[model samples]
Target: MNETHSPAFQREQLLAQDAATSNFNYEEFRMQLQNRISHLEKRARQLQKAMWISAGVLILCFPAVLVIEGFRLTEIPWVLPLWSGIGMLSLFLAAVFSGIYSSRYRPLLKRAQYDLQLSMITELQAQVAEINRKLAER
Candidate 1:
């Protein structure tokens, strides 16, 4: 059975492959690095938006429940009140979950950014080394 690689593992492998190249393909490496950086930036923005949305909804929960309870819509059955409470609870939980997920996404983005920086620095060093070699040959 073939072992399945996780996405993170796969990304690391790709970066390693690029970093390990003895002959640098400047265009391809730059494009790949730029693409990865842009992708991570876009993802981070989207997740940040989601986090803010979730936070807004979460913050509104108390007031929403208060407003609903204050309405005095029904008297005897109490079903609406019960359902409203449950609904609020569910919404709150969902918001919390979204926020938590967004938080996780942030670290992933940060790590990707760090990797991008490292790759850039490595490429720069490689270029410098190549230049030094040529200078020595002259």
Candidate 2:
């Protein structure tokens, strides 16, 4: 008997086709989720590093300003470099205090690294669980 004439042949053919497509779709979706998770994690790390650098600079600004003022560099009249240094000091102080109500460095930075990273990681792990669930059901 020809294969097309057999009921088993048709059923097996359909099942094989479906399985192939489903596996492909699952792999593609999983890869997309993993890529997204990696991108988010990388961004979070970069942001954390940047935040730490900013915090360090802000923290150092206090003593740095005092040192500059104490050196009487501000008294140098018509010197562009001295004026620019004073201007930068003023700008740094302005940024440090620009935060609402508290006017602090840490709060303004918000320390958002951990929470954001956790959320994305949780999402990625949840997708993994979903994949496992589907595979188990199959």
Over 1-138, each residue of candidate 2 has an lDDT whose tens digit, in order, gives 997979999987887888656567777799999998788666555555555565566566667667768886667675547555665765565454443224323443456688998999999999999999999999
Local error of candidate 2 at 17, Å? 14
Clashes of each: 0, 0
Per-residue C-alpha lDDT of model 1 across residues 8-116, encoded as one tens digit per residue: 7777677778755635787898999999988977776776776566556656655765665677544537756775675576577667666766666656655657878
Show the colliding residue pairs in model 1. none
The C-alpha stretches of model 2 lying farther than 4 A from their native spots are 1-24, 76-138
CA lDDT of every candidate? 0.70, 0.66
| Model 1, CA-based lDDT | 0.70
**Candidate 2, residue 113: lDDT:** 88
